[model samples]
Target: MSIQKIALVGNPNSGKSSVFNQLTGLNQHVGNYPGVTVDKKTGSFPGKEGGKIKVIDLPGIYSIYPKSEDERVVFEILKDKGHKNYPDLCVVVVDVTNLERNLLLFTQLHDLKIPTILVVNMVDLLEGEGISVDLEKLSELLGGVPVIPMNARKGEGIEALKNAIYDFNQTTWTPFLKQYATHDHGLKHLPSPSEQIEDTDRRFKKITQILKFCVKRAEPSKSRKLISNRIDKVVTHPIWGYAIFLFILLLIFQAIYELASVPMDLIDNVFLLLSQGTRDALPPGVFTDLIAEGIVPGIGGIVIFVPQIVLLFAFIAILEETGYMSRVVFIMDRLMRPFGLNGKSVVPLISGVACAIPAIMATRTIDQWKDRLITIMVTPLTSCSARLPVYTLLIALVVPDKSVWGFMNLQGLVLLGMYLLGFAAAFLAAIIFKLIIRSRQKSFLIMEMPTYKIPRWSNVGITLWEKTKVFVWEAGRVIMAISIILWVLASYGPPNRIEKAVSAIPIPENVADDAKMSYEEQVSSVKLENSWIGLLGKQLEPAIAPLGYDWQVGIALITSFAAREVFVSSMATIYSVGEDFEDEATMLQRMRQEVNPRTGQSVYNLASGLSLMVFYAFAMQCMSTLAIVKRETKSWKWPLLQLVYMTTLAYIGAFITYNLLQ
Candidate 1:
């Protein structure tokens, strides 16, 4: 009844997580290993009447020897006794469908000499494919260690596996012993070992001999070959594969805009109603204004994108699960070779849609230093969810609310265009960077193409929910804080002067029922020229004038660098002061009508709108991205270079667009 710990380890795409989910159910917590960003998942199950079992879901790794950073973490944890926790038992999850390759990792675990269980998962696929694994013989050959066959998807053989874990005893199953372990067969032979080394070596040899005896494959099934041939015909064709990939990407963008619009609208209206209700229920004061205007609007801006974020992640998960992502890497590799990037960079580039920070961090998988650096440099140009708000607002401002081809919304098309622009910029930048930074080695691509399977809806749902939750929570906090500060900055004016100026404005007798004055008239009566924010805006006017932006636009440009979405909240906070704008949309509408005192023309002309969009499209506007870049690169060099390069590009782009329009 001693507390026993079990660790689940497996190859990527081996359904190791499915096994963990089956064993642990909902009683689990996912976190990071101490001092590392790699995910650590743990859960406990009742063993006997009162005894309990602890299960740890280790990160999926291809080999214990370790090549990538994530894979190295697994090796370090298993090898180093100094690590906080050690498992009493290791459950090596093997894909029965791909046993030869999967067993490579299993042999490594056996060498560790931890009490072990081999879970041959996906047994259901064996019969249909004319492959059969002899379970009893396999168990007997592997020194009597339990070998359970399971179809994790259908909940088959789970009880037996649980029972095996509960009753597991090292003495009950004789350790397998043989010469030439599968993984170590190609390596140089080691000298005769001491007692501890000899014991571990015997265990590994036994596991290997058992694997060779028990595992059987029907002579090279033609299914994989046939599927690969058919897929390669179109997907890896010189021309068609690239075209198809681009088309699929366009389809994803279209789906994100059209499918998520209904839910986004629903969220927008709900938050708006909630804000109005709060205003009516609360006593009138600065507190009410602050809550209703600053906090609510700021947070609402981020919440509105939840539906879109979910849809994006859902689509990405589906792509990854179906194994099409590998083909994408295959196709992109050919296309990216000229740009000096490996094909695998496609994963991080695709992930940049969620956020650049994680996408940049994902470059750890790329082995080449030059490729990794170039990917990190240009990844920000991929339109992240943070940019979605800016694109949404600007597209709404400019594009007509009409549909084309009876399906595509005009606004959606514009949004799609912006995404394409970002993609094009990233590709071009990669090409330029490749040409500039010379590397000696010609890196070759080698990617495992996993078998295609229908995506699990449950997995997709959980992934979408978790990712959207993080976006809402992290972005929500920043927006709320900025909104409150902006509200205060805009609401309070210069010392005494503005208040005296407001009192001096004459009221005509004809409209002398001052309480009945329209919200517009009340705002117009205020001496906004003397207000602190107004003065600050005016001072920035000269600096922004070349870009066709007025002082108010300058204020928005300054605040937006904290986060692109904050531009909308900053404008809302600015416009709400001295005016009774009912909502964010009204604030935008009012902004369009405001005239420049110097030019006697509308402040938001076509030139300024174009300038604003161009600026946001290229700016390093997310603080989260900067922090993540710093952490991932472990140096200020890359992040600082990103900040300088992106800001310079944004300025030049905006300046050119503004000058052309003017």
Candidate 2:
């Protein structure tokens, strides 16, 4: 038998994704939807008859009628039968707890004549809630559609769902719902805004009649829903909520510093050894130099940060899975509104901590144009994971590692403060945009809060794996390419410039071995100063001098425009080129020893290190983010304005920081 396609659709928080995960395990990949930048997730599994079953998990929506980009994508695919992604069958997943609201989209699918299996998820909550559902009766009422009760978190009903898909033809078919059946169900025939409201009322009336006979309920214990409400009372408390969130952030940063140190050290040492080993194993030439000095250390600079990145993602996944993130959004809505945003803007802002690309893409969910545009403009101000490596490196260089306040690591405290600073800057920028931008549409938030439950470890693990993979794979490619290019520019100079600079270094004939090695080092440094990249950095030096940055720092500032995280790799590539790799000193040790020849001061002193950190915190350094902003807004004006304002902010902030500390 040929392979068949099945799509999983549901309202937000309806456990649809859990069902998809249960069915497809690790056989999935994420890509963009056709002709759009929205994510498309597809996976496949073997069926009972040994045929393949492909599954596409569409974006969650409340109705078939389009209101947002996500809904429009879903609507386009489902309404067109000839569309390549049009599924052979559809599985409308629903939360057993919120059946009526979730079924709104299912009825629309039914009326459109798409074969669908209604998967009633989270059925395990039924007994505890003193509710009973008759699966057979519900199926009969729904025109003989297959209704499967599932606990997707525990992998229940997966086999039954697969069985239904395999034998869908054997099931009886019935006429569409009488009211919606009158139309041809084509794109041009879609009901207007007012007509949609009336049709929705009719669908609900019919759904309520079906539920009245098939569902029986009784008053149950106050342990679940009541407990959730009680917890929310404290967690969403205006005063306590912000405090709790800050405490959580402090703990997370401390864990990142404490727990990840061992592995990060191990990775650093391994890569150092790899670079040294490659140099020893290969013949001396440009190829060997590129591998050891350029590619190895560059890739290592990024890979070493993986441990910290994993912990960050793990915490985010746990928060989302335990249903606390929604409450966060709820609590933040009031604070967000005054700044020309609502609760919905909170997701993109918080998600920006992961990456600005998807965070900007997430704005598709916000319906108001002015609000979405403002959200996109400020989202990048949130210090993302890309900034973590830079922050940690600079913090280690300047801040003491000792504990403050009896237990809190000072370094972790500084990291938290940086994140808080980013949040403050974002809010301040939102205020400015609010004043400048005009909009008549009033913004509001209507969201559902899910009952709190222990996070599913399987789901958390999957999220960790996917997020880490993307960070490494996407970042590694850019870092590797830049590393090689930088190595070339740093290793070789224009014509005879490098040779003349090196030959000009003077040495005594009867010098000691130490003095001879010193002469060699001096010659290397002089040659590097005249290299192609060096000349470029020198050209930028005058512009950045007031910010306490040298030509070397200027080089990194330039290369890192490709990506924020590449700053570390760029530094690694710059320092490693035209230098001895056999030394036992680590990268940090090398950086510590660097000094300004003219001033005779440590290059990475407190003033400069802190200044650099502040610069990265506010800079518009990532080209990917700029391109995404242009795509999302469909105009160069917003992104261009964003780049100018942010760059100016970074320069002024760095200058003030450097001058104050000096």
lDDT by candidate, in order shown = 0.75, 0.88
lDDT measured at residue 487 in model 2 versus the true structure, 0 to 100 = 94
Show how many residue pairs clash in every candidate, following the order shown: 4, 0
In model 2, which regions exceed 4 Å deviation?
1-3, 182-188, 508-513
Q: How far is 595's C-alpha from truth in model 1 (Å)?
A: 4.7
Tens digits of per-residue lDDT for model 2, 1-662: 23389999999998988988888887888888966778898999897677779999999999999998899999999998888899988899998878888888998888888888899999988977778999899989989888999999888888988887887773545644676555554455668899999989988988899899999998866777688778999999999998888888899999999999999899989989998899899999999999998999899998888999999999999999998888889889978988898569999999989888899999888889999999999999999999999998888888888989899999999999889888888999999999999989887798898878799999888878878888999999999899999999999889999988887888658689788778877887887799999999999999998888889999999999889999999888877886777776678877888998756888899899989999999999899899989989888999999999998999998999999999
* lDDT value for model 1: 0.75
What are the per-residue Cα lDDT tens digits for candidate 1 across 180-283?
33333122332343743565455456555666776666765577668767987887788998888777777787887788879878877776676777778899
Clashes of 1: 4
Q: What does the lDDT read for residue 503 in candidate 2?
A: 79
Displacement of residue 177 (Cα, Å) in model 1 is 6.1
